[model samples]
Target chain A: MNDFEYLEPATVAEACAMLKRYGGEARPYAGGAYLSIVMKQGLIRPKALVNIKKIQELKGIRFDPSEGFVIGALATHRELETSQLIREKLPILCAVEREVANIRVRNVGTVGGNLASGEPLTDLAQVFLALDARVAISGPSGDRTIPLEELFVDLYQTSLGEEEILTRVIVPPPPPATGIEYIRFSSSSVVDKPCVGVAVRISLNADRKTCGTVRIALGCVAPRPMRAQGAEALLTGHPLSPQLVEQAAAAAAEECSPISDLRGSERFKRGIVRVLVRRAMAVAYDRASHASTLRLRSGQAGSA
Target chain B: MKKQIRLRVNGMDRTVEVAPRTSLLEAVRDQLGLTGAKLGCDMQVCGACTLLLDGKPVSACSFLAVDADGSELTTIEGLAAGDRLHPLQEAFMDCGALQCGYCTSGFILTAKALLDEQPRPSEEQIKDYLGGNFCRCGCYQEIIQAVKKVAGI
Candidate 1:
């Protein structure tokens, strides 16, 4: 690692000033999990690091029934894994957080860092995309909100400008009878990056006989995490069954463009995605059915 | 580019001067002369550099020493109470849970944090918590027994 000036800004405005002054040489320091490793490997050398971990605006998890769930970017993976709010509202994300790298990494790696680093093997952003999550970004001009899907641009890259910082993520509440699940297949240890990751969000209509809306997002199979639109289209407004799930899974597998890496071969990745999509859909559908039952019982109790 | 960092290590307050690029592991071992936390892998893969920062296990080899300012740090050397070993340490010794001893300190520190957070962790929880620490000599069963013995599980 090279020697560089370390600056700690107490507020977001101050941090923005420092970043603007330093221009391309300064980097916002979140949880240094990824940046430190890359720097140690001699991949990137920033002349200055503006530590924004102290900024209060970027640190918490809150959930509202009407407004949905809001997560401060500085919230560590450990925080997400243990947060009751996250567990109640977005249990799928909690499951994914529990499996990130290991406990040591989870203790320090922030959600913002995970998304901003633009690592392809990550599970959070993929799941966020499925849930129609939005990110609140702050920059020199002001703040702007964008869907989480659009934030990702390419391999190790994001749509964020050089000066913009992702401060928070807002996930809209799951529609009535909606169920979500994230599943992945790693070639080696559980802590290793996934060869194929799939996230599915499905909501059944009032009759519980057909799909209302469905989303399928794939990760670690492309340059950036992407939605399997072709697969999702197959399930939308159609009755979900074993046959339908198989067809949808095949479509998702074909939608991915994976390259052969150390994790697994390209063909193996497609196969894993196909299998994961099917399993994920089954779990999501079952959960959605339960959710509908719960809603029905609650409504009846209120009426009585 | 040298900066003064003030932090508490093993219940003692100290100030050290380090270069901007110095990692917490380097500062602890080189500047402060506390070499208990070994630098097994510069990367965060192996937990040989595990240290409890504010009661949370972190990889010191990759953590910036200056970032730990105002934080309480505990290394393996902090486990003993003057010549008396901590319960976890005693258990490891009785169970012979070490081979080369290179990964012992890291594993012990990680296990200490785990037991503190969950006094009676299940075997699965124990395995998950200490999964970050790697035992190159393959004393995993012994390590699990040592932790279970300390937890009375």
Candidate 2:
């Protein structure tokens, strides 16, 4: 890695000021996993690294009766994998974290760093989108909160301002009779970057026969992880059936723009997306219908 | 520019001066002269540079040396007490788990972290934790046997 001045900021305000002072010549450094690789490869050369690990405000996992789960930006993947509250409440997150990279990477890679990196071949953003999460940002202008869906603007890019820092992720609790599932596909080894990832969230209508709300978030299939709105529209307010799921899956495949790569061809990725979308939506719906993960709570579903 | 940072490495508190670009693997092998943690994949994917950072396995190759400040770190050299080998190290020897020995330190350290968390992890759990560490010599079956022996599962 190229030599750079390391600046440690003790608070969100301080970090923002430091970034603003350095402007484009500085980058916020956290988790080390993402930045070190890129820096070593000479992909980016920042004159100074504003290390945000010391910012106490950006650390811990908190849950409230009304606020759902608030995850600290600096919290590591391993922490999420073993967090008692996440395990009990959002167990799907724990399952997904287990499959992210390896034990060493997960031990130090932060959730916020993963999302903020906007790396298309990732797991958390789509899953968080399915759970209807929001991000809290601190920057030179002021503090602002935005839905997670708005964060990703493109591959390796986010809507975050130059001086903004993602401080925490707010995950609204899944309402009663809501089920979530994420299926990750790799064309080669299990540890390879995802070829296609599908995250599905479904809420059952009373009488448990119709799908009241549906989210089909996909990753590694476009410039950024995106919602399969066409597929979701086909299923929402409808009683999910084998034929309907097939149609929705096919629709999801059509909506995504996958490019041919070493992992798989564009054609193969669409096929994987179709199969995974069908399976993930089916499983999520089944879970919702069974109410196996129901935790009674009141909150509006996040907009797509 | 160089910055001074203190780390409790293998039970010894020592201060090392490093540049912001210096990785923990370089500091341990060059500054502290603890060469047990091999530098295999410069990227974080391979586990050849695994070190226990505050009791959790992390890739020293990718982890910043500056980040180790005020934290407890364990390298392969710390596993033994005096002349007695750590149980995991002894198990690897008894099971003939290592052929090339390049990835042994990483595997043993990672296994130590796993056994610390889950004393008697099932076979599946064992595989999940150790799956990331590559044994290019293909000593995986024996490596698993060594870990199971230590766990007594």
Candidate 3:
């Protein structure tokens, strides 16, 4: 890696000031998994590295019933995997975190770093996008919140301002009677990046006869993780049947533009997306319906 | 630019001056003369450079040495008690688990972390725990046996 000045800021304000002072010459260092590799390969040469891991504002995981789950930017993948609260409230996240890039990388790789890197194959961003999460940013002007979907501008690019630092991620609680699932297709156990990933969030109607809301997001198939809005729109307010699910899956496949890479060819990834979308939607629907039925049973018991 | 940082390695507190981009693996091997951790992939894929940072196994090759400031680090050199070999090391030796010996330190440290967290991990748990470490010798079954023997599972 090229030589650079290492700067550790104790607070968010201090970090922002360093970033503003260094401007483009400084990069915020988070997990350092990606940064170290790129720097070693001479891909990026920064004059200084502003280490944000020490900032006091960017730490901890808290869940509020009204406000939802607030995950500190520096929380590692291992923390999310073993968190009892995350397991209880959002089991899907735990499932994905447990399988991210083996144990060592997950031990230090932070969620905010993953999002900030804007790597298209990242698993958390897709899951967070499906959950309708929002990112909190702090800069000279102050703090602002933006939907997670708007954070990624392109491959390895983010919409974050030059002096802004990603502080935390706010994930709203899933709607009542909702089921969330994220599935990735990788060639081997050792391969961390997925060729294609699909995340589905489905909320069933009161009677479990129609879909109230559906979110289908695809990862690694394009320059950025994107929501399959066409597929989602097709399912909303419509009774989910075998034929309807097939149509939605087809639409999702059509919406994505995948490129051939080391994981697989363009055609193979598109095919994988179609199959995963169908399976994910079906599983999500089954879970949402089951949860709705259980809630109805408990409501009747409470009244009785 | 060079930065001075203090790190506790193998129960000994030592200060080292390193460049801004120096990795923990490089500092331990080149500066401190603790050559237990090998530099394999350096991209965080191979776990040959695994080290215990605050009790969690992380790729020292990718982890910046400057980040080790005020942190407790455990390398393969820290596993044994004086002359006595650590249980994992003894198990590997008795079972003849290592053929090439290049990946031994990484596997031993990783397995130590696993057994510390879970006393009697099942075979599947063992495989999942050490999945990141690559054994170029292809003696995986023997390695598995050694870990299971150490865990008494």
Model 1, A1-304: lDDT tens digits are 8779999999888888888888878889988999999899878899999899999999999975665788899999999989987776677777788778889899999999999898988788788998899998998999999998888999999988777789998988777888778887778877777777788888888887688889999999999999999999999888788999999999999998999989888898898889889988887887788884322111100000
DockQ values for all predictions? 0.81, 0.89, 0.80
* Model 3, C-alpha of B77: deviation from truth (Å): 1.4
Model 1: per-residue lDDT, tens digit, B49-141? Answer: 999999999999999988998899999999999999999999999999998998998999999999999999999999988887899999999
Pull out the clashing pairs in model 3: none
The best-first sequence of candidates by lDDT reads 2, 1, 3
Q: Put down candidate 2 lDDT per residue, A1-304, tens digits, no spaces.
A: 7889899999889999999998878899899889889999999999999999988989899896777799999999989988988887888888788888898888889998999988999788888988989999989899999999899999899999889999999999887789788888888877778888889999888868888889999999999989999999999889999999999999999999999999899999999999998888878887888785455221111111
Clashes of 2: 0
Error of 2 at B2 (Å): 0.5
CA-based DockQ, model 3: 0.80
TM-score of candidate 3 on Cα atoms, chains taken together:
0.96
TM-score of chain A of 3: 0.94
Residue A300, candidate 2: C-alpha displacement in angstroms: 27
How far in Å is the alpha carbon of B95 misplaced in model 3?
Answer: 1.8
lDDT of 3 at A179: 76
* Model 3 spans > 4 angstroms off: A292-304
Superior by TM-score: candidate 2 or candidate 3? 2
lDDT per model, in order?
0.87, 0.89, 0.86
lDDT (10s digit) by residue, model 3, range A160-276: 998999999999987778877788888555446787888888887777768998999999988999999999999999878899999999999999999988888888888988998
